[model samples]
Target chain A: MELKGRAHKFGNDVNTDYIISGRHKFKTLDMNELAKYVMEDLDPDFYSKITSGDFIVAGSNFGCGSSREQAPQAIKCAGIGAVLAKSFARIFYRNAINIGLPVVECDTDAISAGDELAVDLSKGIIKNLTQGREIAVKPLPEVMITILNDGGLPAHFRKHGTFNL
Target chain B: MGKTIAEKILSRHSGTETYANEIAVAGLDFVMGQDGTSPLAIRAFNDMGGEKVFDSSKIAMVIDHSAPSPLEGVSALHKLMREFAADKGIKLYDIGCGVCHQLMPEQGHVVSGDLVIGADSHTCSYGAINVFSTGVGSTDLAAGMISGKLWFKVPETFKFQINGKLGRGVYSKDLILYLIGDVTADGATYMAAEYVGEAIDNLSVEARFTISNMAIEMGAKAGLMRADAKTEAWLKAHSDRVSQPVEADPDAVYAKVKEYDASRIGPQVARPHTVDNVSPIEEVEGTLIQQAMLGTCTNGRLEDLIIAAEIVRGKKISPDVRFIVAPSSRQVYLEAMNRGVIQALVEAGAAVVTPGCGPCVGTHNGVPSDGENVISTANRNFKGRMGNNRAFVYLGSPATVAASALNGKITDPRRYVR
Candidate 1:
């Protein structure tokens, strides 16, 4: 599968509280409602600044706090195509994939804010349209691809009646 | 071919000889979710066509994140968790039961060598007792609840060998904060942090819990320690289950190994906006604070409360500060009260709240106002962690928080510890 978007860049250690604050979680659990406040702490107008299918590009250890699914769910709900980072905290990595949000581990130094980019998941390649460069990323394990193809763990379970992987 | 504690446990559970970076599907010994994450897990469970949970006895749900429901929407989510727990015949820890991390071990749901999973990042706290436990998301928790099994990519281990003895004012909180500052937030990403050596061996069970609980802050999958006599004694006091500790092989491979002289470490603190932004007490001292918190899953045990009480005995806190204390559990509350810890704190101008995660997660019961500064014993000092994004949070030991409360500013606890 392939994804195309303009990158929304962030620095290293973009924690979950910064992704979506805990204050919002207490107020509501609705992903769409929470999506309105995604990255509001770091960028006050993040929700209004981007269109659907945009990408959130971050440095190492993205999503490095709380196990709130809302962090990934909010990104997905905000219609982000994927999150590309140098690395991810373990729980956040599992969460993004389990919820059908593609999280790619790639060197994001070549990509800047608002850079047009294309990611081919199966082929493990990232093409930076703005920089005219190509970078390699480690392809996700086969099970994760299967789960994503089935539209997340819930949908995968719905189709298979159990954990297929 | 030697294996670390994590590898051995995973291999035993998966019925395969697993190693680092290898994927294995293992049966879970226990599964847990708190109100913060359980509501979503329940929704995902239903969406996945889940009817009955696999082994209701092995499943637990907690309601500590926002106990007593600060809003109607949150109340509805709590209700959903309650009804789901009831319907599935799972153990439900209602409001005031305390944080899930403390309750799981206190209630005897965890044991060494068990593969446990929770929908809270601090679930790594169980690793203190030698369990190979880690956190997951709501959907992953739901999947584990439904199938009683989950997949894992065995993590490489990073071993921290600490020696010597800590100073009078220094505690495990300072040591862990020092480690975080050294490793940075992501240095141990996707790795199991094995904390062992003379310093760790000398720490109390409660102190070990504090160290393991913040493992997630360093991006570690789990923070583990080999079970010893102290662990056995603690397990015996907490539960009837027999201990099955796992240890790393002498020749076990490690991603990296770090050593420290605990005696040389001073009282440490993690400054605002990020946990890895650390400084010694001398650097951050005299910074004014509006609130001082002494409780959470990290350092809310009886030992912590006792230390705070000792520092504040016969002395009143600064009138400019709002000193809050919330025990991690009812058991801890009862023990503190029995030992006069609660009385000392209350007499010193502290407002002791219920036994749960009060003001730690920023849900309710002490949310700081805008631009305020808070020094807390809880882990994590990210922006908005105390419910207000504009507020600043500094993480420290309970003694430091208590001393700072007395002075209305960040102060060294050593002057008061004696």
Candidate 2:
């Protein structure tokens, strides 16, 4: 599985409230509606600044607060190709994978905003096209890979008739 | 090898020998969701072709995040949850029943040593009773609802050994804040924080709940404490189920261990935009506050309210401050009311709203205005947490918040604790 995108960089401890503010959650649970405000708290022009298939690169502990699926769902709905960070809050990592959003854990110091990059999931490598460097990432667990291959937990369930893992 | 509580509980539920860094498919003893997350779980459950829940009796849902529905869209979502709960014969805690974290334990949905999961991050609060509970997203919650099982990468345990009696006006909230300050927000990512020693043993179940509730602030998957006499007594009073406690072995391996003397700790607060940006009350003292809230899953119990009431019993809060108090549950509310705690707060100019998570999540009720400063007992102080990104939030204990409300500034509570 290969994903190509531009990188949008953020800092450490990016909480869920920053991913999608709780105010928008009060108005709608619709991911598309929430997507318009995705990362709006952190970057007001985030939605308009990037195209589909762009990546959100960040430092450690990304998505650190709340278990609101809207955080990951909004990112996926906004057509983000993946999220790369040094680490992730456990729930957010699980949520992203459950929703079929690729959350890669690797050192993101080399990636900068607007840098063209390609991720090869199977190969566990990130090709920084703009910088002409390749960074290695740990391969996801087999079960997560299977779920991501099936487009997320729901689709995986639809195909397997139960939680395959 | 010795095992920590997390490893033991996951091993028990998974029917395998599990340890840190290993993935285990564990059966859930209970599952829950709140209004903020249940609507999505219901949708995902339906999407996964779920017709009937794995166990209706073990499933619960609460409408507390935006209790009473602040908008038509949210109300529709509430209705969807209602219909779904009815169709599945699951328990539905409608508006005002309480925050799910409080309700789950108070309503007897969980017990010590159980592997519980909820669709809210604060689900880790149940770890106060020795449960290996953690939060998950809606889809994983749906999966748990459908299959009664979910996978977890059993987290390494971080031990916090705190001893010595807490000083006057120094509550568990302060200690937890102090710990968060030392560790930073992501210090314990993917780890279980096991708190023990004299301090924990001496604290009430409610105080323990406050400590465990904020474990996520340090990126801990679960904040656990061994269930002792106090925990057993509280469980006996609040729940009918028998408790089965798990404890880490003496030789249990830990990722890291830190010790603290609680007596040396003072009233602590987390300043604006981040929970880990903590400071002693002296550092943030005299900062003007526009609002002071005294409730949430973090500190809305009867003891917390009683503490606040005692602080502001006969005095009026600052006219410039809009003081709000929301009990964590109807049971706590009724208990406080019968004990005159609510009357004292109201008499002191505090508006006691419905028992649920309203202002804390910025859903409705008492959102702060732009550029306003608010002090609250609830956990988390991230930007936009209170509905206004421009507003500033300070996190403190109930006593601290009440004391600050009296002065309309961030003030230490020790002066008023007597």
Task: Calculate DockQ per candidate and list them.
Answer: 0.85, 0.85
User: Can you write out model 1's per-residue Cα lDDT over A46-97, one digit (the tens) per residue?
Assistant: 9998788889999999999999999999999999999999988989999999
Query: Could you tell me which 10 consecutive residues in candidate 1 chain A have the lowest summed lDDT?
Result: A21-30
Error in Å for residue B304 of model 2: 0.3
**Residue-wise lDDT of candidate 1 within B1-418, one digit each (tens)?**
9999999999999999999999998999999999889989998999999998999999999999888788899999988888899899999999888889999999999999999999999999999999999999999999999999998999999999999999899999999999999999988999999999999999999999999999999999999999999999999988877778998999999999999999999999899889999999999999999999999999999999999999999999999999999999999999899999999999999999988885998889999999899999999999888889999999999999999999999999999977
- Per-candidate TM-scores read 0.99, 0.99
Clashing pairs in 2: none
Off by over 4 Å in 2: none
Second chain alone, TM-score for each candidate: 0.99, 0.99
Q: How many pairs in model 1 have backbone atoms within 3 A of each other, for residues 3 or more apart or on separate chains, i.e. clashes?
A: 0
- The lDDT of each candidate is 0.93, 0.93
For model 1, the local distance difference test gives: 0.93
Judged by DockQ cut-offs, is candidate 1 incorrect, acceptable, medium or high?
high
